[model samples]
Target: MQDRTLIFVLLLGLLVCGAVSLTVGSPLPAADLLLAAMGEGDPRHRLILLEIRLPRVLLAVLVGWALGLGGAALQALLRNPLAEPGLIGVSASAGLGAVIALYFGLAGVWALAPAASSLTGAGLATALLLTLTRRGDTLSVILSGIALSSLAVALTSLAMALAPNPYALSEMVLWLMGSLKDRSLHDAATAAPLIACGSLLILTAPRGLRALTLGEDTATTLGIRLPALYLRVVGGTAAMIGGAVTVAGSIGFVGLLVPHLLRPLTGHDPARLLLPSALGGALLVCAADLAVRLLPTPQELMVGVITALIGAPFFLLLLLRRHLREALP
Candidate 1:
């Protein structure tokens, strides 16, 4: 499909999925839900649609967009198709930060504390990675990312293990598993600025990324400042991934999957992949959340679980295909 056509289709899917999300779990008809959202229907239905559902839908879209865009930017920067926000440890560290806030009871008192903490954690991880890999070789960066992610994961596990009570442990586990249930407009509002800013930052790097495709020396020859490009990508990834983890916990693979899925449609141009990936991510998350709501289980499945179920198999298939191609010779 043409890039423009694919993007339009993804946007249409996002809108349709978002609409379905708002009305999916409610017993009221779609028309009634729409009326309630506009404040002209039953009060209970109105509360369900507006107070409960709309914010969740919005959060899903925002978080998914950030992850997808951040992933694409990172992949472009690293020139690694497998690179993602989580692979660099930012998401794990951000989750740890939020967990610390929750464990210390800070999140209960300050509406923004969790997100702030998450951002700090993500920033620190990026800083450490940049410091250790001063030469910025692709292999060095990836290795450092792996080490940082491992450390973050270990710390998070330790925190869970030492939780003061079962309730705390359960809360941490559920949060890590990821869900959009019970999120409010306040959560969405708090995350919006960070996500928006991060997206703008990432969007600014496409020219540099496109240039770098020819190599750092070539990009420098083209007047792209490598230092500034690195900073922009790191800062943008931190903000986007941190905000996303804060809002929805460590929901995985939207970043890894969305860009990969849409890259071909964008003619394999990293610059062209950003917007379509964002829209596709939003559409996927919204649809997944709706599916979780509609499932027959006594408790709704976590959105993360659904994404994992989908992404894990796809990842294995990707590996298998690569191995087969490599073995073909």
Candidate 2:
């Protein structure tokens, strides 16, 4: 498909999925829910529509966009289809930060404390990643990221193990599982600025990423400032992924899944993949969240669980395809 056409379809999908998400959890008909969202329905319905579901929809869109855009940027930077936000430990570190905040009761004291700590953790992880990896070495970068991610996950587990009470441990575990349920507009507002800033930074690098595809030497000769590109991509990804982990608590695979699915439609142009991937991510998350609500299971699945179920198999397919290609030649 043409890039513009693909993007348009993704946008339409996002709109439809977002509408479905808003209407699914309520007893009211879709039309009535729409009216309630617009403040024209019963007071109780209005509260459910405006206060409860709207924020969740909005958060899903924002988180999806951030993850998708971040993933595209990271993949372009690493020049690897498998590259994702968590590959560099940003998400894991952010999760650790939030876990610490919850375990220490800082989250109880201030709603935004966990988010603040998450951002701090992401920044630290990025710094450590850069410090540990040699400049312009993709293998080193990935390895360092894996190391940092492992360390962060270990620390998070330690925090949970030492939780002061069962309630605290349960909260930590549930948050780590990831869900959009019960999120408020305040949570959306808290995450928006960081996600926006990170997106801008990521979007700025498309030309550079395209140029880098020809090789670093060629890109450097074309006057692309590699250092500046690295900084923008890393900083932007950190901000976006950190904000997402803060609000959604480690929702997995949206970043990885969206880009891989959309890249072919974008003609494999890393720069062109950004917007469509963002839209696709929003659509996927909205659809998945809606499914969780609409399904007849005894309990609604966490959004992350839904994504993991989809992504793990997709990941295996990619691996198998790579192996087949290698065997063919």
Best by lDDT: 2
Distance (Å) between predicted and true CA of 14, model 1? 0.6
List runs of model 2 lying over 4 Å from the truth.
127-140, 318-329
Specify the highest-TM-score model's number.
2
Please report the TM-score between candidate 2 and the true structure. 0.92
lDDT of 1: 0.84
Clash pairs, model 2 backbone: none
Q: For candidate 1, list the clashing residue pairs, or say none.
A: none
What's the TM-score of each model vs. the native?
A: 0.91, 0.92
